[model samples]
Target: MTDVQRGTEQASWRTLPGFTTVRTYQPRWLSRDLVAGLVLTTLLVPQGMAYAELAGLPPITGLYTTVLALLGYAVFGPSRVLVLGPDSSLGPMIAATVIPLVTANGDPGRAVAYASMLALMVGAITVLAGIFRLGFVADLLSKPTQLGYMNGLALTILVGQLPKLFGFSVDADNFLDEAAGFFRGLVDGDTVGPALAVGVGSLILILLFQRILPRVPGVLVAVVLAIGCVTLFDLPERGVDVVGPMPEGLPPFVIPSVPLEDFGLLLAGALGIALVSLTDTISTASVFAARRGEEVSADREMVAVGAASIAAGLFQGFPVSTSGSRTAVAAQNGAKTQVTGLVGALAIAALLVFAPGLLRNLPQPTLAAVVIAASLSLADLPGLRRLGRQRRSDFVLALAAFLGVALLGVLPGIGIAVGLSILVVFNRAWRPHQAVLGRSEDLAGYHDLTFHPATTHLPGLVIYRFDAPLFFANARSFRDQVRALAAAEPRPAWILVAAEPITDIDTTAADMLGDLVRGLHEQGIRLVFAELKDPVRRRLDHYELTDTIKPGDFFETIRMAVEAYQASTGRTWERGPGSYEIPD
Candidate 1:
C-alpha cells in the first residue's frame, strides 16, 4: 500500500474503541473466556427470549438481537467484560413505541419494522453523540431519578406480566387500571390454574436456587423443567399457552419500511430509548470497570452500544443495552475479554440454526416468570432505604419518579422522570447554599460561620463562599447576599470571595459581578477573589471586568489574601471564642 493510504487506514483503525484491546489479546485468556461465554449463554438464551416477548416481538427476535448485539459490541465495545444484549429494562420502552403503530389487523411484521426503525434512529443518535464526545448527556439522568425510574419500571413490568403469568390478559390503559383488572380476573376465576401453577412454581424455583446456589443457572433450570412438564403432559390442551414453534435459521436483513407520517412518534420513542439505554450502559459499564480497577470511557461505550443497536436493528430487532446481570454472570464465570460475548452470540446463533424447536414447548407463563424474576432484581428497595436514611429530598425525588411511572404509562413516565431530574438540578442551582467564612483556632482554614457561630471573621474583611457555580439563576441572589453582608454592623473595607467552588461564571453572572464591584467600590470597599479557577478568571477577562478591577485583587489562596490584607493594613485581629473540635 502507498504511505498515505497506509497512514489513513491506521488513523481509521485508531477511531475504533476496542482495537487496542483486540491488538493486545493473549492466547492464555482464551480458555477462561470460552468457559465464561458458555456459562453466560445459558442465562442469555432465556433472558433474550423473555425480553423479546416483553418487547412485543416473537421470541426468535430476541435470539436475533442477542446474537447481533453481542457480536457488534465485541467488535467496538471498550470494556473487557461488558455484555450487551436484549435488556428487560428496555422491553417496555420498545413495546410502548411499537404497540400503538401496529395495525388493527395485528401485522406483527410491520410492528417489527417500526420497532427496528426506532432502534435505528436511537443507534444514529448514540453514534453522533459519541462522535461529538457528548458522554455527559447520560449524566442528565441523576442516580435518584434513575433509581426511581427503575423501581417504577420494575413494578410496571411485574404488573403487566402478572396476567400473562396466570394464563390471562388485561386490556387496561394505565398501570392502576391494569393492576385492578388483574385483581378482578383473580376474583372472577378467569386465570388458568395450570399456567399459574407453572409460572408460580418456576418463579419460586428460580428465586430459591438464586438464594441457595447463586452460581447455578436457576432460570435455565426452571425454564427447562416447565418446558418438560408442558411437553410431556400436553399442557397446551389443558389451557396453557406455550411459545410454540420459533423461526428457524438466521435473521434476514431488512430495511425498515415505516412511513413518513409516523416519523415524529418514532423519533420521540427513539430519543427516549437512546437516553435510557445510554444511561444504563454507561452506569453499568462504570460499575463493572471500577470493580475490576479499570476505567470506562463513556464516549467509547456509546459507540459500542450504538453499534450493537444498529446491528440489531438491521436484523429486525429492537434496541439493546448493557445487561448488568449478564455482565455480572460473565465476570463471576471469569470472563477475560470480549471473546466471551462473541462466544455467547455464536452459541445463540447455533441454537437458532440447529435446535430451533428446543424451546417450542416452553410455556408463556414460564417466560413471564423469567421476566418477572429479572424485573424483580431491578426494584432497588435497599437503595431507596439508603436514600431515605441519608437524604430526604432525594428520596422524595425518587418517589416522584416511581409514582410517575406507576401512575402514567412507560413512555410518559420516562418523560416525567427525566423532567423531574432536570428540575431538581435546576432547583439546587437556583437556591444553592452560601456561607459567611470565619476562622476557628482548632481548624486551619476558614469554615462556615453558621456552624461555628462563636468563630469570628477578620474585622473589616468579609470572606464569603458560594457553594455552587456562579450562573444567571443564582447571580442575583449572590449579589444580594454579598450586599447584605457588607451592610452589617462594623462596615467591611474589603470583600474576599472564596471562589474555589465557583467553577463556572456565565455572562449574566459576570455582569452581576461587574455591578457589585462598582457598587462596593463606591462605598470604599474593594472586591477581591481568592482561589478562583483560571478558566473562570478568563471568563471575567472576556467580560472586560478585569480591566476595571485591578490585577492585584486576585489571590491564589485564602491565606495569601489574608496576608495581603494584613500587609496593607498592619492589623492582627483577635481570634473567635469556639475552640473545640468540630464533630463531622
Candidate 2:
C-alpha cells in the first residue's frame, strides 16, 4: 500500500468499535467508576500528604495537587482508565529540585512558591516537547536503566521518610545525610515511644493486608484504622504526633513569585523534573495501553500530562503523572471512558470541601507506612533478578543505579543510570555481532546463526548478519568484517547480507558500504543485500550506494536471494555451497 493510503487506513482503524474495547458505556459502568474513584481517593488522600512531605511541602499542598491534577487529567488525557496524581517516583525528584533553593522546613511559603514555579516550568517544557513531537526522546532511557532508577528511587524515598515515622525530624537534605541520620536515630533509640509503636503497628498491618488480601486497599484501611485508634485511645497525649487539622476548601489560583537571581538554578532543576515526569508518565501509560491492546500516542500523552501540570501549578500543586496503582484500580473496576478520572477528581473535590478534617488526627506513622508501602511496590525485584540471570552488565547497571540513589541522591542516580544505558548502547554499536547465518539443521524452512562451537559455516557463499543499525560507531568494524571474510579460503563470489535486523543507517555507514561494494567488485565478487527495511534502503539510495550495487542484487528475502544466486551461477546444490573458484 502507498504511504498516504496506509496512514489513512491506520487513522480509520482508530475509530473502529474494537479499537479500545470501551463500547457500551452504560450507567452501570458509571456506578462502578464512582466506586473505584472513591476507593482510589481513599488511598490518594494519605499518599498525597506523604508525597507532599517528600517533596518538601506542607501536607495540604498534597491534597491541592491531588484535586487539581485529577481534574486536569480527566479532561485532556487519552487513557480512559489512567489515574493521574502525585507519584512516589516524582517525590524524591521534586525534593532534589526544591531543597537546594528553599531550605527544608525553613520558609514554607517560599518553598511552596519555588515548587509551583518548578511545576510551571516543567509544564512549559512538556508542552513544547509535545508541540515539537519530541516524545521519541524518552526512548533514550532503556527499560533496564529505567527499572534500575526506579528501584533506587524507591529505596531512597522509603529510607528518607523514616524520620517522620519516628516523630522527630532530621536535617538531612539528600540521600547520604538521610541514611546517616537514620542510623543515628537508630543508635539513639530514645525517641522511640508512641510514634514508633504506631509506625511499626501500621507497617505490620499494611504488610499483612497486602499478603493476605491484595484486593483490599491496605493503605486506606491502615489510615482509617490508625486515625480511629489515635482518637479512641488518645494516643497523641502520649507523644504520638498526628497530622493535625488541614485547611478545608480548594486552593485559590495565584501566580507564583519567581526571583530573578534564582532563575538559573530553578531552570536546571526544572529540566530534571521534566525528564522524570515524562519518563514516568510514558512508562505508566505504555503499560496500561499494552494491557488493553491499544497503542498509546506518546506526543498526545505529553500534551495531556503537560496540561495537567500547568493546571496543577496554577492551583497550588506540584508535578503529577500517571499512577500505576490507580490506573490498575480503574481498569479492574471496568472504567470505560475519561469519565472514570472525572469521577475520581469529583470525589476528591467533595472530600476537600466537606471532610478535609476527617484525616486531621491521622497518625504521621500511618502516613509514613502508607508511603513506604507504595514505594516498595516500585522496587522491581524480579527485574533485578532477571538482569542478573540474563546479563551481568545489566546487573551491574542496576546495582550502580541503586547505590547512586542510596548514596548520591535521586538526580545523580538518574544521571548515572542514563549514562550507563548510553554506555551500553555505544558498547553494542561499537562491536555489534556479525554472524554467518544459514538454514538451521533441525528447524524447517527457517534460518539461524550458528553460535555453538561445533557448528560449521558454509564456504564460498557468505551470508552475514549484523544485529544492530549501521552507524558511524560501527562502520569501520563492518568494513573490517567484509575485508576479512573476502580474504578467507575458497573466497565467495557472492556475498549476501541478511539486513532484516538493520533498522537504520547513517551517512558514515552508507559511505563505508559504497567503499565495500567497490572493493568487492575489484575482487570480482557480487555484493548483495536481503530483507533490507525501507528506511535503510532509502538511506542507501540517498548515498548513491544503491546505484553502485546492481539493482537485481537487492532481494526481499534471503531464500529468494539464495535461489537467484544459485540459479544465476548454474549450480545444483544437495547441501549448502562447499567451495568456489575465485574469478581471475
**What are the RMSD figures for all models against the true structure?**
3.0, 5.4
Q: State every prediction's TM-score relative to the real structure.
A: 0.94, 0.86
Model 1 residue runs over 4 Å out of place are: 1-25, 454-457, 567-570, 575-584
lDDT of 1 by residue, 437-465 (tens): 77877787888877866455466787888
For candidate 2, report its TM-score: 0.86
Clashing pairs for model 2 are none
Position 65, candidate 2: lDDT: 87
Candidate 2 deviates by what RMSD?
5.4
lDDT scores in order = 0.88, 0.79
- Clashes within 3 Å, all models in order: 0, 0
Any runs in candidate 2 off by more than 4 Å, and if so which? Answer: 1-28, 286-295, 331-337, 439-459, 521-526, 531-538, 545-584
